[model samples]
Target: MKPELENIPLVKNEEKKRFEIELNSHFAFIDYKETSQQISLIHTEAEPELAGTGAAAAVVEKSLIYIEESGKKLLPFCPYVFAYIKKNPEWKRIVDQRFEGYDKL
Candidate 1:
């Protein structure tokens, strides 16, 4: 059976500026940069072993949850994150209003 996304422990490796989760021996992560009022989600990645296993989505979800709880605006710079937010419109609330593509999402 596939692992549960909710059961995965998301770690904010602030030193690395990434939120990470272990998948087997590898990690799925979202690269981000934070400012006083906004966080730019720069990229998302999952190892080959973790691909197609929802790892990327899991990381994105957890990262978005964290951003929402922190009350910071989000600039979803990565295409995957952008598509994910487009699919889940409710997440748009956390998007930075100044983002060039905010209205497009």
Candidate 2:
């Protein structure tokens, strides 16, 4: 099930080697730079009200799209990102390293 991008708002900005996104004003993202040809995911949190509603997943998807479009590799460090990639095969090509023992991507 693909989450709607419009419903899941994303803002991408950079801080040094990190690219970040804020989701629903509840979550913050940090994308690492210069790491094994990968984008390291960091910081993902949903507001209490948005939890269990797939808001985090939506953010991950949006972030993934941004990374893919930018032609960078992904190294999912955040637990949410790790899990999302595991369940979604279409995103596999972008992943360079997997977390939580999931290394296939």
- RMSD (Å) of each candidate, 1 decimal: 1.9, 3.8
Residue-by-residue lDDT tens digits, candidate 2, 1-105: 234434555666654444434454565444555454557787666667666666666667778887898788877777777778778888888876444454554
Error of 1 at 82 (Å): 0.3
lDDT on C-alpha atoms for all candidate structures: 0.92, 0.65
**What's the TM-score of each model vs. the native?**
0.94, 0.67
For model 1, the local distance difference test gives: 0.92
Which prediction has the highest TM-score against the true structure?
1
Cα deviation at 80, candidate 2, in Å, is 1.3
Which parts of model 1 have CA positions greater than 4 angstroms off?
Answer: 1-3
**lDDT digits (tens) for residues 9-67 of candidate 1:** 88999999999989788899999999898999999999999978898999998999999
